[model samples]
Target: MTASLTPLPLQGHVLFRSSDLDEARARVAEVFCPHRLDTSGGGAFAARHHHLAGQGLSLNYIEYGARTRIMPGELGAFYLLQIPLAGGASIRNGAQGYLSTPDRAAILNPHLPTVMEWEEGTRQILVQISRAAMQAHLAAHLGGPSDRPLTFDGPLDLTAGPGAALRRLVLWLVAEADAGQSPVAAPAAGLMAGQIEKTVLSGLLDAAAHDHMAALGRRRAAPRPRHLRLAESYIEAHLDQPITLEDVAEAAGISPRGLQLAFRQHRGTTPLGFWREVRLARAHADLLTAAPGVTVTQVALRWGFTHFGRFSELYRARYGLSPRDTLRAAQGG
Candidate 1:
């Protein structure tokens, strides 16, 4: 049976505003988990929470004042990654402790007791995931069953690489949900929503330091022929969607770097180059058949080309004629 997940509001929850302590605490707890919250920032507690929820995953933006502390009870079923957008937090998870900020994120381990102290005026976006969902998903990607629990070390530095991409994915998903453009919110998004969720899951699985880190990051071993074929097929099918190299790797059950090497070895081009080639090819066909109302720029955008001049240059270089010229000829103008 195909399980139906409650869709996110394609346009996310509007800024949900409240200023009462009892209400804010209860509300935040309801969205997350119930726990003890004592505020030493004793002034009135005002907060804004913008949220979007999908299958077993959710993203939220929250800002509330606190000078003392918070004891969010153990989340035995879910994992959380808390990242501040403004101030920061001093957090204690079991024996682990860290200072989390905009440039860093705290991966709140599931099945552990937790406490946190957020500075005054701290605004943060929290990503929550079901532990079972992620672990099972990870095991599938590794092509086997996992014997041990996945646990992270500490705060994730979001300044560069996959960490940065992970942060951007959360923000972008929130924005897309808010605009009703994401698979979570758009009726036609269908399997793409699940695909996006899987992509996020795999990205974090690869980025975070966990017990499964070695297996996930094993780049010395190359991907199998079938894996390479799967990655290429995923890229070709999703060219018009907002997919990244990591997404393609996830679909192929390989790390991004490993997938790149496989592509270079087998196809004589980088994974991204292959994607560009595929998109350019389709955009060319679209330009040739463009109707009177259709424009060259529109065709380029449809193929995920964001830069008009760059797309034109590539289009001209590949087709030996500009996209506009092709469209004009198709229109008989």
Candidate 2:
């Protein structure tokens, strides 16, 4: 039998297990159904049957048992973080489309119409986090460019990594809540629901960065092999050099202006900015693997940092801590 559990305004959790197709459809339509739903390019997607739930976030899961095509239209209710547990589903957003690998996931903007297709015996998880919830979690990180509704810019591989662990956790939480195993399961589910939302956001950012790089690659006018090789070789060899735009440009045999534009177009960052990030990362790595009594200054200097004051400032800003503090914390001093 299909059962509908109306979620609380800010939180809810539930699980369903049923063989009755009609009942399952009824419950999904009633509980987590989209608000301003419309469809074009008519077709059916699949018969969904699975256990699902969420608290303080709208998480839904289903196991598909058929092949079908979903019409395109805005969900008009909430953003969806769709994770396929088994089998696969394909999605398109007018520009580019991708298929979801098992364990790998995709994010769909509910405000725009999307097309989804699936095969028989498919199982998946869908978490619908509200606009308010997203704004709350992504306060400072939601700057620069707006890149949505164009493609799925999130993790395409879902093995035993953090993404897979999260998928397992969400499944368990929903199942436990549905079974009412513990009286506190509802609240506990709420806490985990927040964590799931954050993970999805982080993965999406990675995918967006990947998409940006791919687009830049396609836009290169002429293959300036010399300039590209010069910039790359200089950055790698002299990462410990007080690398600057002028320095890198000179090595590349190109004007500083040309160098800057090339890095921005191809590498997504200017030469100097990318160099600094590389140095700081190297410093962090040294701190982690350096031998005993390896001071932060030693690590910084090894990575081409001459100004302790400036290096420490940038390190702290990028990594959220001073170098000394990181080494101490790492060694448990």
Candidate 3:
């Protein structure tokens, strides 16, 4: 599918309400991937699902009255984070099984087949993230490629720390959607929508317990000057892409902490500072030869500078003129 430029926008507010098992199943497939729901608590079976989605992430509220078992099969390309709002559920991810309550969350790893059994009155807030987008973000964060699958240590504790904070944010976003005031629903939130999705994914990677969590946060020995040169070269080559500090560190075959220490000790600036300087220089060059009808915002965004004001401020500091001034002069010349 050709990706939609706008994250969900207003299209995801559709509510699915049904009492028939077959009916609910069909509606859910439209919101999430195909899944089978079977009731074990008996009586009248009913389900409710309210889905909100962006380009790379989705937030949903789901409830199935009467005890139930949902087989989502092999997610294959997505991770479903289930946070119960009421009651509890037992989630099986591969050999490990997690019993999640209102204070806990279950992150269903994509590679593992997942089975979720809910209590009779359970309700949950579900966040679905695209696997490719998430994995790419994780690799970028760790400053190296993820050679193996990111395995969660266990269930997430929502009562404290990053997990609690992430839950609050999700709830706030959900409340916004419920009130029809969500940023994703705003027409002006195009690029901003993508940022929100990326932030959510990054937060999950940062907070959630995973095999890579330790490595990403671990401090390593400072990189040699030769390694710093390799990183600088990599940054110069891939300046146009979304290159992070981690990318540079990985290219230099060192940890992010080590790369930062080396840059400070040698260059007197952080790796990110050096990277920003290079980008500023490149943006200046692009502005000089920018095509007709090109705006400063166009040039700024083209060079991976998202915030126009910040870019202008940095550009002015480096070149002794605002980006607009530089572009204006280039056009005039």
Candidate 4:
């Protein structure tokens, strides 16, 4: 029996459609890593790829109309989350193996060796996130650099819980792209696009079982220490000025290392992470009630955020909307 399929995603954003196996392999390799693609199953070879690129990630829809085997070895620089829309694929990553279907998705860690056999007629939505971004994000959450590389368990259940929510979020992004309202579209939407990318990365980290889950859970359960409140207040008061970990520690009356430990334990983030959040909140507030002549760039610069793009991204991630959007709403635009 044939599996049901949704309408093709990124229909208006086709990167390529080709019947030549070599051309398909070469083009797809330019986007992802180079891989061995073989279609020796006697099925006709036709491939299509549709893509939407963002600041730190990309969303893609791809299918090879023929049964094909792909050996990409270690993906080295990025992670790939494959959600099958129709039919299925057999995926082997590292020492784990699974049959990925519409109800079950596959997440490939950057360090894992991957070999996949995509069944004929199978179609999938792939989310690609860079390793540097993922590691930096994880470090922010852990409050320090991880001793080991971030790795996720292979099979993800998309029927319920976090996995289900992740699936819905990805589809919603695709829908937004289809409607020409995606944050990934114009350069003006760069900030929003960054937030959306972070959301996807964070969603995947939360949805899949990963190496740092236990530490994350422990941090979440830790009681907020009294010193954190003092540090937070200090950060809030200094939103308009430059500050450092030592300064925050001094204000909190703790050693720098001790303050970092406290922040990690009680706040689940580093002191700088907390400070960034506070600054972002301040920027958000400013945007919400800005004077007619105020601009996003001006507001961001006022909050000690010199990189306008980064400030916008961080602001959107914290406020659930772009700074420009907030300013527009406040201006009754």
Ranking of candidates on TM-score, top first: 4, 3, 1, 2
lDDT of 3 by residue, 78-150 (tens): 7788888778999899888889998989998877777889988787888887665675566456443344556
| Top-TM-score structure, candidate number | 4
Candidate 3 clash pair list = none
- Quote each prediction's TM-score: 0.60, 0.44, 0.64, 0.68
User: What is the per-residue lDDT of model 1 for residues 1-333, given as tens digits with 9 covering 90 to 100?
Assistant: 002212322225744667776677787777677888778746557666776667767777776755637798676657898867778899898889989988999898776789998888777778788665675576466443233456787788898988999988887887676665666543445787888888888778766777666665542254648878898789878888778888989999999999987765555457777788678868877876777799877898899999999998876544445788778878897
Best by lDDT: 4
RMSD of 3: 13.4
Q: Candidate 2 lDDT, tens digit per residue, 1-333?
A: 012222311122334444554555565666555222222233443344343334435556565355645553655445566776566778765454788866567667554467777655556667665533343333224211112222345545556655556666555545554665522233555455556557655544444323354533333444545796688788879988776788889989999999987766555556777677667767876785767788988898888888899998876555445788778867877
Global lDDT of each model?
0.73, 0.57, 0.74, 0.82
Q: Write the per-residue lDDT of candidate 4 for residues 1-333, one digit (tens) a residue.
A: 233444578887899999999999999998998999998677789899998887667889999999999999988768889999888999998998999999999999777799999999889999888765786677566544454568898799999999999999999999998887887754557667777778888888899988788777775676457777788788888887889999999999889999988776655568888777657756776887898989988988888999888887765544435788889988888
Task: Pick out the ten consecutive residues of candidate 3 with the lowest summed lDDT.
Answer: 1-10
| Lowest lDDT 10-residue stretch of candidate 2 | 1-10
The local lDDT score (0 to 100) that residue 267 gets in candidate 3 is 50
Model 2 alpha-carbon drift over 4 Å, by segment? 1-27, 34-55, 140-155, 160-162, 172-333
